[model samples]
Every structure is written in structure tokens, then in C-alpha cells.
Target: MTASHNWPPIDPADGWALILTELQRDLERIDPDLVMGQVKQKFGTLSVSAEASDPALADAVHGRIAAAEALSARICERCGQPGRIRQRPDGWYQALCNRHALEAASEMEGES
Candidate 1:
């Protein structure tokens, strides 16, 4: 696994929690009444503002997801060897090596 040398001041393990805290704070400060109205109207929330958007936030989310993927890639769920993220037929997030991905497909089928 490639060590992310460009990681922020926080430890890698703590990055996700810290970023999520900031994300929640940012969202909460954005006027919850408007946010709720938008959600009811559009069935989805708006994207973060450019001004409020932190490069660190993007990097943090990517790094956490990627780390999960990288871990799945390294250890096969079924065969127990180096694995990689493969697309599941059911179209959901399932971290598995090539072989276990298929296994996960059945397990994850019909799951939202």
C-alpha cells in the first residue's frame, strides 16, 4: 500500500471522524430550514458551497473510501489473499477482491 505522504495534520485513522465533524458543522450552519425544504422539494440535498468546500474534506473522504478499498484489495474475503475492488452486479458498495466480489453480489442482492 502506498503511504499517503501528503496526509493532513490529523492521523490517518482519525481523519474521517474529524472531517465528518467539520462537514456536519458546515451543513448545520447552512440554514437547516432551507436544507430541509430543499430535501423535501428535490429529494436530494445541495452540494457544498465552493467557499465552504475544503480541499481537505475531499481528500479525507477519498482517502477513507480508498483505504477501505485498499484493505479489501489486500485481503480476500473468501480466498484470503490479495484482492481488488470489483464492481458488484447489484450495484452497491461491496469491498471485495475479484473472487469475493461475486460472493458479495449474492449476499448484497436486493439490499439498498
Candidate 2:
């Protein structure tokens, strides 16, 4: 199975984009008929949901998802640059560059 025709939209330049592309390639190699369901990012983590026609492919799919999530923690969501996981005052986590982090902090201060 190939990536779903309705896979969630992801910016081509985003770091997660590369991860997803690699995932698709790897999954296809393991099981050419594996159906990629929904691919999305939530709370700074990459979630790749898939349905494997064969139960044997389940472990491989889960391994790929785990690796991708680890990589996402080091990629800036806004600029696709290298970053570290940072928590905002409101307890939301994001991987961001210094500039964007400062900007977000300023915006939060303004809101207060």
C-alpha cells in the first residue's frame, strides 16, 4: 500500500517532511502493500499511522514511527532548522530556533 491519497498536508521544507518521505520508502520496502493512513504532528511529535496488510509488518512500522519522533524533537517546526526542545510558559513544547523562540516568548509576554 502506498501513502494515502489524503495524507495530511506537510510543508515540503519542514524537517518532518524528510522523515515522512524516508518512512514511505522504508515501509514500501518491507511491505509493498502497506497502507499509510494519517501522518501528522502533535505536540512536537511526529505520528505516522498506518495499516499493514500483514501483521508481521507491524513491528517494522512502529520502529519507523519511533525513530521519526526522535528526529522531530531536534527539528525546528517553524523554520525547519536545527533546534532543541523548549517548553513555553504555558507548558507547550516546541523545537525552535533562537529567533523564533524569542519571538514566541515576546508574544506570550504581550499576551500577559
Best by lDDT, which number? 2
Q: What are the TM-scores, per candidate, against the unseen true structure?
A: 0.26, 0.78
Error of model 2, residue 111, in angstroms: 3.2
Itemize residue pairs with steric clashes in candidate 1: 73-83
Query: Model 1, clash count?
Result: 1
lDDT of 2 at 28: 73
> In model 2, which runs have C-alpha deviations exceeding 4 angstroms?
4-6, 13-15
Q: What is the lDDT of residue 4 in candidate 2?
A: 41
Clashes of each: 1, 3
